[model samples]
Target: MEAIDGLIHGFGVAFQLQNFAACLAGVFIGNVVGVLPGLGVMTAISMLLPLTFAMPPVAAILMLAGIYYGAQYGGAICSILLNLPCHPPHAVTCLDGYPLTLKGKGGTALGVTMLASFLGASFGIVLMVFFAPYLVRIALNFGPAEISSLMLLGLLAGSTLARGSKLKGMSMTCLGLLLGTMGTDINTGLQRFTFGFPELDDGLEIVALALGLFGVAEFLKSVNAVAPVSTSATRIRIADLWPSRSELRTAIVPALRGTLVGSLCSMIPGTGPTIASFMAYGLEKRVSRRPQEFGHGAIQGVAAPEAATHAAVQGDFIPTMSLGIPGDAVMALLLGALVIQGITPGPQLITEHPDIFWGLIASFWIGNILLMVMNMPMIGLWVKLLSIPYRYLYPSALFFVCIGVYSVRSDMFSVGTTLAIGVFGHVLLRHGFHPAPILLGFVLGQRFEENLRRALLLARGDLSIFVTRPISLAFLLTAVLLLGAQLYFALRRRDEIQLPPSASPILDE
Candidate 1:
């Protein structure tokens, strides 16, 4: 009943004319960015965060959250039409999605992806709405010791979650924490690693780093090589718009299965769509009547991964909005936006900012529906965008990277720092180090440090407080168990001189 009232109030807030318009605009623009490779929901949301300075919090978050899941639906358009995944998780969609395209059943694949995405997203949001109350209550009372232990668990769990060696992941996490430490120590107010450069005082902008790492690097790689995109597609007509009943039935079970699995995995910090899709795909195959059809344009294949990814996208918001723990790059962006808007995301946010919370939740259903519309008949426009050649696209991308970086605090030092991070990120990329764990660490680093300091201060530097707190102790023990299991597998892998199947799928690029 409390959940119902919150949802009702959310609808009340979201129904305002201006808020409705913004919701539509956000979802529409989300599709545009989603179709464009590298301009993820995080980039789009972060770039647009400043624009919401004047808008009501309800409208701003509604639009921002709209962009979140709308991208999930819109990304599939490119993955299905072009072989390139719009985002990495959409790469899972490309597995069977592109194959379906080759068979000229692309229309069916797109429809299934859209429907499954909507349904799975809805499922996740419903769970979040009801579960948030209980979750938030428990999360709110967590002290500094509990928080620090949670961060430690998240860090170690992330090491096992992300690609590469546990040691390498630990190294990357430490490096990110180190990099994150550069600007100024909040506690001491002293600059550490400025290197005497005035620009180093502000540290590196994530936008520039991300733009270069994902946006610019992708452009550079594309410029020198040919990427696969279908040129012979007969523009899909409306007559073939909807999926057949048989096809819908084929997709239902996979979508449901994906939703169930994706929701569970999403609660784990550091895990995201990459694992969710793989788990969903494996689940489908395990229960499949025709398991051999996977990777061969199976509708279930397309539906399962798409559904799981959508659920993951929505479920990822759980930690971000409730516990103030960012689950991914996009959540970090949302956190920044929340702070900039003077709306802190924590346990009290639900009670203090009910209008913002509910409004954002309600807009999700609207944004998802808008995405379905965007990806269908309007897909023609999105696909037409792919026709714009690399020369033009690269310069435009470079412009955004430089401009977005410079726009933040008018710092040229940020641009320079970005280029350095980009180059370093590219090096890490080549060396098989996924930059995600670093991002996770950088986001959590400051808070982790803050919590550790606060806990020590509160306990008068007594380390026994962690062991005395039952909640903190439980979290610590869980982290230890997870690390022990992960280390065992890692050692076995080293002895066999082979990578884990989950970490490296031979079929992946």
Candidate 2:
């Protein structure tokens, strides 16, 4: 009864004239962004966050949240119809989905993909419905000691997720943390590393840092990077969106497995949909009877990754809401947006802002339904999006980054910082470094320091305070275990080697 009443209240809030319209607009924009390449949820949400100045905070957050998860339903449209992946999460879909198209089963692929995605998302929503609030209640009681320990775990997990040498990833993490602290001291009324520049007083604009690190760095990589000219995407048709009986059966187990894998993996900070989907697909392939069929248009292949994408997207929101730790870049941007709106997304969010919490959660399912209806009709549009020439697209992507970053700070310094970080990020990439973990570190580093200092202050400068607190001890133990596992795995693994993208798609081929 209580849940129903709360849900009714949510419906009352969400179904209002302007709020409903915002929901539709958000779903529409989400599909557009998800269908297009290079424009990630973070960039899209950050770019649009400024436009929310005149809108209600709830409505603005509702729309941005839609863009974040609606992509779970829409991104595969391009990956299946066009060989080009819409994003990293959908990259695995390109493996079997495109080949399924070649086999004249494009309709089956699209249908099953949509169904699997819906199921996975629904599973995550169920988890959110029952579990999220309890988690929130527990987290709401956390002290600075506990918060700091959580951040430590987050950084360690992020470092573990990076693809390069752990040391190099840690180096980048240190660099990001140092950069994160470049402006003002949060504790004292003093400036730490501003170099007497007023612009540095506000710290590095997150939009600039992320855009430079992920977006601009991506553009720089493409300057001379090989572009495969192919004509494989023009074969899309509406008939490709329906699933057959056998195909549906084939998708069931894989979808279920993928959902379980993705939802579980999502709880671990920094494990985004891309890695979750890939692991789910790998697990399915390893356990399948026809392992040989993998990367050769296997139906299970399409189901697992698609399902994982949805589950992971929903699951990633857990840490974001519970602990204020963004799971990935998109979540980071969402966190930033919430901060801008004067709505901190910590444990108190659910209790203090029931309307925002319940409304957003309810809207997720609405957005999922809206996603299917919105994306199915736009398959042709998304196919055309995939058909766009890289030459023209990248420049526009860069321009959007520039405009978005500049809009955040109203200064050219951000643009310059973006370019500099981008170039430096590119150079680091070439020298075998990854920025994703650095982003995680950068996002949590300040809070980690604050919490650590607070815990120390409370303990009267005793280092043993970490072990004195039960939650802190648990996190420390987990970190030690994680580091131990990483060492064991790294030692047992084969020599490091780079694999080409062409070969990458079919590593399990």
Candidate 3:
């Protein structure tokens, strides 16, 4: 009943002209962003963050949220038609999507992808509708100790679960924490890590860091890299778009399973849409009787991963909104946006600012519908986007990055900082180090530190305070177990690698 009432109130807010326009603009840009190779949704959102300063908080959030999931709809277009994954989450789609294209069923693959994307997003939205409110209620019981422990768990999970070397991820996370410490200590008036630069007193501008790492750095890395071209992609016809009834029936179970996988992944910190899509594809292959068809134009391959990606993308908001714990880098950026807008995210968010929460949820339904309608009719246009030269795209995108960073403080220092970080980020990218974990660490580090300080203060510096509280102890234990499991797996794998060939049953066989 509450959910129903909230939805009704939400629709009233979403229908407002300004908010509606923001959602439309966001989804449209997101679609284009997703169709363009090398430009991620994170980069797009980061670049646009400064622009939201003048907008209403609810509308700003609606727009940014639109971009995140709307990208899911457009990503498969490139993956299916041109064998390119504009979005990382859709990379798995390229396996079967491109094969179907080669077999002249690219339209069919796209149709299935679209259907799966819609269904997956719908499922995620429904889950959030009923789940987030209850989560908020449970979180209201948490105290400083529990909050701090939970934050520690989030940091650890994000670092370890990010897509890279766990050691490197942890190192980057520590680096982020160090960066977060650059500003004056909240409790103490003394400054640290300023290095005598007055600009450092306020700490690093998130706009600079986000734009530098995700936007400018990506542009620098992808500037010279060439994308594979597909001539047949230009020939897609509306008539060839729909799959047969049998294929639709075949896709239903996998799509549902993928949605389930994505929803579950969303609840776990650090795992996001990209992981969900890959896991879904793997699951589908294992369950299929004709597993051999998986990479050879399997409809299940197109459906499952696309479904999972959309589902996970939408579900990613649950943790961010309900617990104030961002599940991934993108969600962290969104959280920053909320902070900038003066809207605190957490259990009290639903009560204090129900408009932002419910309105954003309502916008999801509206945006997804718009995406579905726009994508099907405009498939040809998106395919044509593949023909656009990288030279034209990267430079244009960098221009916006520079402008956005500069706009934040109207200072050249921010632009220079962005460039410096971009160069460093490019170096990291070259060495196979992901910058996402860094952003996660940087965003969550402050909250962790603050909560830890408060918790200690409440306990009069007693370390046992954490363990005395069952919830706090549980979170700490989870963090420890996560690290232990990763260590155990690492050592086990190393041992297996070092075993003598004669001692292996596989070698004897």
lDDT string, candidate 2, 1-509, tens digits: 55566667777888877777788888788877787666666557656666765588789878888888876666787787667686788889998998988888877898898889889998987777777777887887788888887887877777776555887767777877787787788888688788888888878777677777778776677656635335454565667678877778889999999999999988987778988999999899889999989888999999999898899898888888767987776777777777777888888887788888778777878888887776677676766665567788778878777877777768898789889988998888787887766666666777778888998999999988888889878988998898898888786553333545564433435
Model 1 stretches with alpha carbons more than 4 Å out: 46-56, 199-228, 494-509
- Least well predicted 10-residue stretch by lDDT in candidate 2: 492-501
Best by lDDT: 3
In candidate 3, which residue pairs get closer than 3 Å at backbone N, Cα or C atoms, i.e. clash? Answer: none
Which whole-number lDDT from 0 to 100 does residue 168 have in model 1? Answer: 83
Tell me, by TM-score, which candidate is best: 3
Give TM-scores for every candidate, taking all chains together and pairing residue i with residue i. Answer: 0.91, 0.91, 0.97
Worst 10 residues of 1 by lDDT: 221-230
Taking the tens digit of each residue's C-alpha lDDT, what string does model 1 give over 73-125?
77888888777787777887887888888898888888888888888899888
Off by over 4 Å in 3: 228-233, 499-509
Candidate lDDT scores, in order, read: 0.78, 0.79, 0.90
